[model samples]
Target: MLLLLLLQQLLLLLRLLLLMLLLLMLLLLLLLLLLQLLILLQQLLILLLLLLLPLLLILLLLVLQLLQLLQQLLLLLLLLSLLLLLMLLLLLLLLLLQLLLLQQLIILLLLLLMLLLLMLLLLLLLLQLLLLLLQLLILLLLLLLPLLLILLLLLLLLLLLLQLLLLLQQQLLPQLLVVLVLLLHCYCFYYYS
Candidate 1:
């Protein structure tokens, strides 16, 4: 009877050991499945990131192109404005040159009128003085005839000298060359800027 009771206890222990081994195997299977699912989730996230990278690069490229176009447009506008300013400056220069020419012409006209008046006054005075001398010579003909003849020759010589002086003009080629050089220098300055 005792042997039979011992055999029953051994069989119960064996059954309990077999049940524990089965539960361990099931736990291991569940852990392996959970690990595979985690790996798949990681792969899916990596694929999503890969698909989005090219789109982000394309957006960045578009933005850069837009910025470049804006920069070129701004540069073109600046150049156009500068060209307009240059045209305005050239027009102003032309107007200034016209005004200067008009002023110079007016001054020349005034100078010509003053010289003419001076020559006329000198001639009138010389004629009046000669008439007075002739009257004196008539009053004392014997003493003053030779003196009056010499004075008449001197008067003729003086008139010839005044005529020669009046015909001569001041030289102005040097001043004109200086003005041309200054205009060229100003043009170069603006072109380089």
Candidate 2:
């Protein structure tokens, strides 16, 4: 009984340790998620810097054309700036789409991780159940041991009884043979007389 109690306490401690480890893993995953978000933010800042480049170039071009007082070049510069603006807009749109896709991917990855955690928890639960089943089997064997011993004793007693019956049969058969000879002798004497 004391040993059983110790085993149960040990199992409890093990369960607590596993739970703590799981919690630590979850914390680490959360930290990784935060780091990824920081990286994504840094990438966004870099993209924003890239987005400003065309506007700055267009401004510099306009300032140069104004300083030179060139009318024909001014019109060309305006058209060039308009084209750059349109390209910038398309680039921005594509970047936005890419960012949306990345966010979705990140969300999917997080969901997958959560599913993996759940699976791990289920596996732990199954392991605990298997341990409990093993304990129950051990207890059942302990319970059955005395009953098995009793059954064996009963079998031995039955074998002894069978032996005794065989001995009785052996003795009775000889006695019956002797009585038959005596009866035969009596019959012969009466016939002779």
Candidate 3:
């Protein structure tokens, strides 16, 4: 009966040792898979940056083009206003030659002055519109700045994590290898004995 119990305990120890080795192998595999996942994430992030570069550049070009077009429109409006003023002046000179009454002359002059004031108001409104556009551009830059900074930070951190995982492998790999060798040796001795 004592021999049987000793035999059972021996079997149990061998079984437990085998279970431990299996668990260690599984743990090692899982750790390796995690390392691979982190590496994949890093590669994907790099690819995204490469793809996004051209898109960001195109957006910047579009903004510059918009600003240029706005300036050209403002110039055209100013030129048009100048042409209208010259035409009005010519008409008034004609009226003078045609012996228009003093009262009519006064009315024409007042009308021209009112038109000038309206043009000035329109110019002010256009200036305000331009200011608003500038403000919007600044706001967009402000928003984009943080996002770009965050992406940069994330990339940096991921790189650091990859290095850390490598370091962990360097530190623990030999120990795990030793443990596996020792367990195999013990199992072999037990089977032979």
Please identify which of the two predictions, 1 or 2, would achieve the higher TM-score against the true structure. Answer: 1
To one decimal, what is the Cα RMSD in angstroms of model 3 from the true structure?
Answer: 9.7
Q: In what order do the candidates fall by TM-score, top score first?
A: 3, 1, 2
Lowest summed lDDT window (length 10), candidate 3: 93-102
What is the Å distance of residue 141 in model 2 from its true position?
Answer: 95
- How close is each model in CA RMSD to the real structure? 50.2, 44.8, 9.7
Reference-based TM-score of each model: 0.42, 0.32, 0.51
Q: Which regions of candidate 1 are displaced past 4 Å?
A: 101-193
Q: Please, what are the lDDT tens digits per residue for candidate 1 over residues 73-159?
A: 565566556656755665565567577776666555655665675566557656655755564454355334445545655675566
lDDT for 57 in candidate 2 is 62
Residue pairs with backbone overlap in model 3: none
Deviation from native of the Cα of residue 77 in model 2, angstroms: 26
CA RMSD (A), model 2: 44.8
Per-residue alpha-carbon lDDT of candidate 2 for residues 111-192, written as tens digits (9 for 90 to 100):
5665675566557656655755665565556556545655765675566567645754675445445555545554554455
lDDT of 3 by residue, 50-143 (tens): 7567557656766786687578668657866876786678667656755755576676676687678667867976786787678668757755
lDDT of each: 0.57, 0.59, 0.70
Clashing pairs in 1: none
As a TM-score, model 3 comes out at: 0.51
Q: Which wins on lDDT, candidate 1 or candidate 2?
A: 2
| Candidate 1 displacement at residue 153 in angstroms | 99
